[model samples]
Target: MGKKFFVAGTDTEIGKTTIACGLLEKANQLRLRTLALKPVAAGAERTAEGARNDDALALMQSASIELSYEQVNPVLFAPPIAPHIAAQQAGKRLTVSQLAGYCRGTLMTPSDFALVEGAGGWRVPLSGRETLAGLAVELQLPVILVIGMKLGCLNHALLTAEAIRRDGLPLVGWVANRVDPDMSCFDENVETLKQFLPAPCLGVVPHLPGASPAALAEHLDISPLGY
Candidate 1:
């Protein structure tokens, strides 16, 4: 059995894939086989083979184990919109049970570390009555939150943490990604999050343009993840 975690972000565009890739890279450094999955994605480009998502492609490249694009991203929509809306446009429905089954089947492959990256924020709608959070609950995976360090991040991070707790899942750790290059009171805000969030800080990633997973891995500590 391998250690698997559900990666969630405080909000969309919060560097969840970047942080998840960094963690996978760091685990690979320790000679651990790694796998990554993006159960649902809203944005994709039409490829000759099929639709491909950039985030899922990046995760596939970062992992030590190779998986087909479809295995990595089981549900994909062409437009960069809310997943539920995109699914509706495609005349498809999204359900937590279906996504969970996809994730569980892929997770059967052996690996030292594996991650299931959520599409957006914790409460992103999958359908009229379903949200992505339900998928995490269905899998019963511990969570690793990615906090986009920026203006108003404190409220977002706190509220997200509260929601995770309310969902009855363990928030094992969090990463602070510096998404805002010029956000005010950055260090102060990180300190406040460390004080309040119900998990240890895995890393604080400074904004670096075009940084590889190997480069970002240098700043992350995976021992907190029990590596």
Candidate 2:
């Protein structure tokens, strides 16, 4: 058994993986056994062994210990679109119950934490009737939100925070990832999130040239989980 977190982002490409990397770095620094999971992936490219997705691979790379890629990303789609639609287009089926079942096993293993990064925005559908929110509740884990700092970030962060609250989930903390360098009022936007969110501000991820997990983790904050 281990402490776990559900990582959701304000939007896709909002540095959710970057925040997960930050937490993974901290777990490794503490010498704690840890793993990161992206239960569903929408985009993928060819690898020697069929196909693979970058988001899921990035999280596994950040972990100190190695885990089978399937253990991390249980549901994968080839298209870069909403997972439900992608599943249909790819002639596959995805359900929240299936994801929950896999994650339950992953969470049951011995470790300090398992960070599960959700697909797209917090509300993306995994199936026609179920949402990512339902999966979060099924897992019964606290949430760590990744807010992409850019124009209109305030609205995204606040609305997502509200949804977390509505689901009766504890917002463990949040990370601010600087996605758009030119977005105005970066500091102000961060401050706004810090004030409005029902959780602590874990850390601020500043944008760096040439995307890599190591650099992002350096700035990402992994505070103590109140488990």
- Residue 189 displacement in candidate 2 (angstroms): 1.6
lDDT of 1 by residue, 39-76 (tens): 99988888898889999999999999999888999998
Q: Mark the regions of model 1 whose C-alpha exceeds 4 Å error after superposition.
A: none
My TM-score estimates for the predictions, one after another, are 0.98, 0.94
Residue-level lDDT for 180 in candidate 1: 96
**Model 2 lDDT per residue over 53-130, tens place:** 998988888886688988888888888999889888878788778889999887777788688889888899877888
Looking at model 1, which ten-residue stretch has the lowest summed lDDT?
A: 42-51
Model 2 misplaced regions, further than 4 Å: none
Error of 2 at 218 (Å): 2.9
- Candidate 1 local lDDT, residue 149: 94
